[model samples]
Target: MAVRQVIFAALGVSVLALGACSGDGDPILMHAGAQNRGPDEFAILPTKPLELPDDLAALPAPNPGGANRVDPQPRADVARALGGNPAAAVSPGAMDGGIVNYASRFGRNADIRAQLAAEDLAHRQRNRGRLLERVFAVNVYHSAYEHMWLDKYSELERWRRAGARTPSAPPRELLDN
Candidate 1:
């Protein structure tokens, strides 16, 4: 009876050890919810409207590498829509001095974008799922970030209870859906 009890205890301990080895906690996903799909439809831009030239011989020589007269100029279009000089869109220095000053008030890091991209890649790789999850190519991004998920309605209620005003927040009843 004593020998049998010892065997059972050892078996239980081994089972727990195996279970612990099954995974590292909080699995991350490499691409989040990204799916393999066709090219984005919004990326295709329409060419500028066609217009007949005043003189056939007066037309400038075509340079494939250079900007075309009929090329879509979205910045110019936006400037025109806002009743500003369309030509201003071509000049980098045409931006308002006050706006530029305010935007650069905090010191800028030129390589910040590259640094962030590298750091994000490292984080995803470091937390990239368990052995079985990685082997089966399972997505665990949402589950991994579950702690960061916000319940907006509950948060608003808590804030209101604490006497904080939320003028633009929707009613709690509307947030049920």
Candidate 2:
């Protein structure tokens, strides 16, 4: 009778343990003493397709020309009156009823040319800044790596002098392993 009771108690405890381990349908499992082969061996299944929001479906396509495509005639007139174009015979820096003839020698609007020049200058300035930043970053990284290599070599020499087992070759960690 006592043996029967012990068996029943053990069975009850095992049943509770199994119940506690019930999962929410995740399929992967790992066991002790198993080597992790890498991401390819233990990857999760692909997820369901994502649904785009309803409001995004109604959004209009963007205009390819952007905002700068609008006519700047009024601004061009102001530029022309400023003596930007000699052929127009408009006095320099003079505002003729807010309609300046900003025409250039090439017959192009001076205001448009000025706007393009400003944009070009800004683009070149940004590129220069980016180039300088990259150069500085590369120099810093090179210097840091040089210092680290020197420090590692010095430590290796110290170990050798202390009669420690000097490897026939440098340590694997020291190589690009």
Candidate 3:
């Protein structure tokens, strides 16, 4: 009975050890909810439209560690906790009861990613990589953003735009062409 109990404990310990080695050795993503990007809340300093009173003596007594009244209300609860009426403090245009202005961008970029992807595909097609560029891959992207100094394609494009004119058609381009 003692031997059996000892064997069971040894088996359990070995199983737990094997479980630890099962990982792929990659860093475990802690903040998967944020797509591993972590929090961006502290990225930019939050500002409010509110201004302080000019009269230094008329100002309210400052607490030991009170939040600034001039600070933007990040949320309705925060505004309420700071002793400010959210309904009155928030502007008429402010949605979500005077929280962050992030709500104003709601539905604004619904199809923007898809549209940008399509545009990217078109841009890549228009500027297809050569054999050397295909090997490197970086040069293709580098040329995409660079200025048209000594452009080889512009000359080719100029030929495509130059059509067979019927009886002296001197091109007056830009909308009239």
Candidate 4:
């Protein structure tokens, strides 16, 4: 009886330990590990209502590859709903010219997003876990970036010691006497 009770207790503790290690850590870093539970709410969008024209013959000839009359135009619809010019929203270059020009003044790489995504994927792959960790599907994101971690409070104190103004920084924690 005593031997059986000890065995059961050890088994219970081992099960709990295994359960603790099986969790998906830091969802932002484990996007690839995310399971699809249901349909994405944002992907389901309502189409524009169908409208009958008073003069049917006045409509342009239907082009097989052209935009449909009832197709959802989210940007234009949003602009129109807000009493703004829908035409301006539909044509990108026509509106916000000054802002766009200022932002791209230093020159712009059209494939910047794609380039960055490739670079990030390469970085993550390079910093991936060891054979055992990979086999077990354990996340190593935090450990991989451990060396790059900054000590913000120490940095604030260092700047203060150097006579740099740190007006925005909160007062340092009070040390007990």
Candidate 5:
């Protein structure tokens, strides 16, 4: 009886040792869902080969038929309205009289020009103040009022000083466009 029990214990110990050793040497069986079924399901499709042209440098020049075409009649009408002759309007270096040429005409001591600039500045300030008031009125928050106030007065003062240093002049080449 004792010998049979010893043999049974030895057999059980050897079986457990063999299972541990087998587990250590065996590769893990990965459950990759449907990917591990077979190569027939996961095989890549063959790509079609591309054929190149024999003469690569024989391309034809671009056609200009689709380019925009301009009509001279409307341009001539516009030039006529701007004080140029409609028939002889196609000449180069023609004076259309569309430009005022203030820099050439008005000296630095021109009272009318200075008065016009001051009036324009006053108009701009009134419009800007009204706009700022409307914007702040839309929002009931007091912080918006403070921000608008600073923007209108302080920023406008800075811009006015900058403008005084470099007084605004009309753009050159007014008739070209």
Candidate 6:
């Protein structure tokens, strides 16, 4: 009876250990986004929204590590206007709205994540995940691996200078090959 009980206990512990390692992600490829969240450095934080670029070809060259052209950062300007610190305004603070209630002044981005996830499902359907990504549930790591780190603004300038239908570069994998 004592031997039988010890066997059962050992089996249970082994099962638990295996269960811990058998998660959705591959341990070798899953370390991105694990650091402390910080302010986006490459983002262009204009004090106000950009007007339509009359001469589309004359804008500054976009960085590979930058945000898109149209992300609206209206709060920084608003906070400066209202005599509040722009840094304090920009940093997330639910209860620290200096001039007006945050809820009253701004629409909460609480549901924005869920909305983006829903759109991402549609995007995945269109783009189609690779076999390894689908099998190992490596969406995050796969995105990091597959990202095209190009300077869109510089690419636009290159195209403008060519003054012809310049052929686009092939995907990174082709270059690797």
For lDDT, candidate 1 versus 4, the one ahead is 4
Q: Per-residue lDDT of 1-177 in model 1, one digit per residue for the tens?
A: 999999999999898668667644334223445444555699999887889999999988887799777888888989999999988786556557667778889977789899999986786687788987776556666666667789887889899899998889987677777
Task: Give the Cα lDDT of each candidate.
Answer: 0.77, 0.55, 0.61, 0.79, 0.51, 0.63
Q: TM-score winner among the candidates?
A: 1
Ordered from best to worst TM-score, the candidate numbers read 1, 4, 3, 6, 5, 2
Sort by lDDT, top down from the best: 4, 1, 6, 3, 2, 5
The residue-by-residue lDDT of candidate 5 on 1-177, one tens digit each, is: 999999999999898667554422212222111233335644554433554658879755666774222333555666779998777755443463334455446545558788988976675455454454454332222332344455544454566567654235323243224
Point out where model 3 deviates above 4 Å.
1-73, 77-83, 86-113, 128-130, 147-177
List the candidate 4 regions with Cα displacement exceeding 4 Å.
1-35, 51-59, 83-90, 139-177
For model 6, residues 20-85, the per-residue Cα lDDT tens digits are: 556654344345544334545777555445679888889888788785546554676688789998
Better of 3 and 4 by lDDT: 4
Give one digit per residue, the lDDT tens place, for model 4 in 65-123: 88786887778889989999976775556567988999999999999999999987897
TM-scores for all predictions: 0.52, 0.17, 0.25, 0.49, 0.18, 0.24
Q: Compare candidates 4 and 5 on TM-score and give the better one.
A: 4
Candidate 2 versus the native: TM-score?
A: 0.17
Model 5 TM-score relative to the real fold: 0.18
Candidate 3, residues 1-177, lDDT tens digits: the string is 999999999999898667655544224342121235555787776676677679978988878777777665566556788897775665446545445356655645668799999997898778867865554332355466455446644544565578634333333463244
- TM-score, candidate number 3: 0.25
Query: What's the lDDT of the predicted structure labeled candidate 6?
Result: 0.63
Query: Please, what are the lDDT tens digits per residue for candidate 2 over residues 71-111?
Result: 33344455577857534544436655344444443465548
Residue 91's lDDT within candidate 5 is: 40
How many clashes (backbone N, Cα, C below 3 Å) per candidate?
A: 0, 9, 0, 0, 0, 0
